[model samples]
Target chain A: MKTENFYISDFCTLRNGKVSKNGEQVYSNLESENIKDFAKGIYKFLELKYPKFHKMDELCKLGFLATEILFQDMEKIDENTALVLSNKASSLDTDRKHQDSINNREDFYPSPAVFVYTLPNIIMGEISIKNKLKSENAFFVSKRFDAEFMTKYSEILLETEKATNVICGWVDLDNDKYDVFLAFLSKKGEKELTKKELNNLYNQ
Target chain B: MAELKEELKEKIIEQLSLEDVEVSEIGDDDPLFGDGLGLDSIDALELIVLLEKDYGIKLKDPKEGKAIFESIKVMADYISKHRTK
Candidate 1:
């Protein structure tokens, strides 16, 4: 069954110490150049209460914050809302920290908390746990944001009844630089979920 | 004992990234897991590493963590009694 009509519903982007939803600037932190501080700023700005947010690595924090911004005004999405996120770095930021912990044999102290987030898919898990989303989830690693792939994959999930809705986009963080563009997709919205539209929103 | 309790609270906060929680907020008898201080199993693992890495106390039995890490006071007592370093 091919489901044709799906809208992009709403979208949010977090990059360069700022957050925007549907091309509108919602939050900005120009004072903090540090990525960790920027993430903490966004968490505080959203007034999020989940303590687990602090435990998340930089990649998960970026994705989690973007998802929170995307779902801020709307009611909770259903459990069938699938998550499809792609990134370039693939948890390299946390991987570096974990590597450093075990790099020296004599000074080794590998933390389980840091070890758990060594995979990029852990970001989706964090989002799912927060929103109670239990549908299909996939984390893809590519050279850059693949808007076309995201659109096609999300469409298949909606058409197959595997997901009533989807929260999909690019969430990549490497070094101190980060880029996130998360969109809420459903049968209702202002813009259609096309490759072109997704690319435009991602670049926007 | 009082000094050890304070140090344990500080170490737990630092090790576990309990950023929002302050050292003063945690009580001496507040349970470390499941609703008291809300520390989870991963934190329990961190406490184990903390015991070994910081205090030079190697736990022979994993079950000892249940009683040893019950609270700030309990952890302090256990560390004081068993710590090698």
Candidate 2:
């Protein structure tokens, strides 16, 4: 019988060349002025040398970078961590890249590297692999970022014991536009999560 | 034949996400799978696509990927004989 159940323990948001933790700026005014370059700068800032990062589509890179920054200071990462991430664009950004590869008959190349990231869940897989988390995970495509939905779903997973810990948020990107809001959730924390609180945090 | 092998090596690195690897590192006669290049099944599929998209060689069976993707030397020879465009 666990008391003081379900709290969104720590949260991180990355947008427009900045990373914030607990609604406070951690890294800001990134040297890169554009989104494409900003993503690379974040990867470099994190000092990640994983070759896979260069191969990933922009959406996966954004999510992967956010997760890396969120968990940078976190000491103990649980194995049963379930990732519940949602996005408005789904995998359209990479889908467009895949389409471009085959659209031109003269320059046709249905590249497997580009084709591999056609699914949104691939971002979760990338993060899971990097974090060494082999557990429950889900990816959703919505018209808009739904903070309430994320909180509710994460609570269910934690309450049902499907996952001991959860990393949930919005990792949406299309072209140069992007927004990432990731939160770490568990039953053993002080900040009890509510819909409004999640909304406030996500908006930050 | 030497030119073709060198071309295949460059294409393999470009097509696949072998970012850290350079064209000079991959040997023409070296094994493409397991120890030599460490290419897995997914890389094999990418090579299959490379054969069709660049050389117009369609491999309908999955088993065909093994013999064709053995080495850059083998791939160059196959492409030289079969390339349509």
Candidate 3:
């Protein structure tokens, strides 16, 4: 299979508890409570734009947002599609809190809630539940965001028929800031995917 | 007695990250794991630590904790009997 077409549906960046673009407030509706709230806010924004999806999870939210913006009637896309996600910090917030509990003698017992989020793949699990997808899932850490890896992996997924479609991108959440960019790629003859096309779709 | 249970609930809430759960929502006899508040194995471990830290009750085996931690009521009773503090 070759990529037929691809698109950039929706992207969100939350910084300092506010949503902004180029230092200008585009939307600001973040309540600083926990990571779940941040993840939910991103989900809600995308759900509003694409109402077809019934469940909302971090990874599914990213995939839906990208698909809605890029593909038309994304529900028509095959369900066996693969997902490739990359992040700089792999649940560091939860890891740090678990470490903090161990560091202090008084609070020597680590909270299990903090420990659950330590794995980087939890986001993938959330997405899978949301989309009802039982597809190949992978999570990788890069020193910095690597767009090339995403492009190459997506290509392999399509060419190998492991997936007719691939949803891939970078999602990183830190102390008070987060950034996400996702794209839905299909086989070339079935869709339009080129290096320049993908660069333009994501680089923005 | 009520004050201690209230404190325990607060500690449980903070430790578990039960963001949607409130202090008033937890019943005195509510099961702390499986069905009532929907806690699981990881939560059980956290409660074990809470017992050790707050009441100086060290459970040598995790299996021993299952019966003692059936619910907040059971947990409170066990702590009252075994607490060094």
Best by lDDT: 1
Model 3 CA lDDT for position B64 = 93
* Candidate 1: C-alpha lDDT: 0.91
lDDT of 3 at B14: 76
Model 3 bad stretches (over 4 Å): A1-27, A30-79, A104-107, A187-191
Please provide, for model 3 over A32-58, each residue's C-alpha lDDT reduced to its tens digit, 9 standing for 90 to 100: 486456545754654553322322323
Ranking by lDDT: 1, 2, 3
Q: Which has the better DockQ: candidate 2, or candidate 3?
A: 2
lDDT per residue as tens, model 1, A82-145: 9999999899999999999999999999999999999999999999999888899999999988
lDDT of 3: 0.65
* Residue A70's lDDT in candidate 1: 83
CAPRI verdict on model 1? high
**Chain A of model 1 scored by TM-score:** 0.97
Predicted structure with the largest TM-score when compared to the true one: 1
TM-score of each: 0.97, 0.87, 0.74
lDDT of 2: 0.85
lDDT of all the models against the reference? 0.91, 0.85, 0.65
Candidate 2 off by > 4 Å: A1-4, A24-36, A104-108
